[model samples]
Target: MNKLFLVPLMLLPSLAFAFPIDVTKKLNGAEIVYNTTTISSNMAAINIQNVGGTAAQCRVVFVNGPENPRVRNTVVQSGSSSYVTANFNRAVIRLRITLTCNPT
Candidate 1:
């Protein structure tokens, strides 16, 4: 029916915008910016930036509904940045990141 078709069409828009959760926080004199955005129907992008005068280590994990988990480790030097991507056979549901930065 027309109503059934419209239901799925309406949800398509949400999927297009359901990506790239941006997060920014200040820790130990360093500014950490992290984002997880959808790259495709089965892939997600991870980006991290360290804006300060120290080095940082980050551990990122991406979890889809019931797929295998993907984890990544990255190091961002002072006044530098990094980027990576996590792939899933399905859509991602949640993302978690842990950052360790040097003290002032």
Candidate 2:
């Protein structure tokens, strides 16, 4: 009975590690804030925020993750945000994200 309790405790540490990505970059006089949260071992939620005062446009791409091989794209507008969800078949060690934006 004690061993059963120990198994869940041991697994807690691995589950505690979640991917939360917050990347900020300047592109064409605008600020792009990219955010991603790991909902589970094989899933993630993505978002992009435009904090600049001027109007801007951006294209966000998510690629190279386990279970999810196809690229996902999101479009964001100035002073607004966009969100997307990505799914994977298994646990992912890493993910690649790309952002392209321009000021209008």
36-55 in candidate 1: lDDT tens per residue? 56677667676778876677
Off by over 4 Å in 2: 1-26, 65-69
Task: Count the clashes in each prediction.
Answer: 1, 0
Candidate number of the best lDDT: 2
- TM-score for each model: 0.62, 0.62
Prediction 1 TM-score vs. true: 0.62
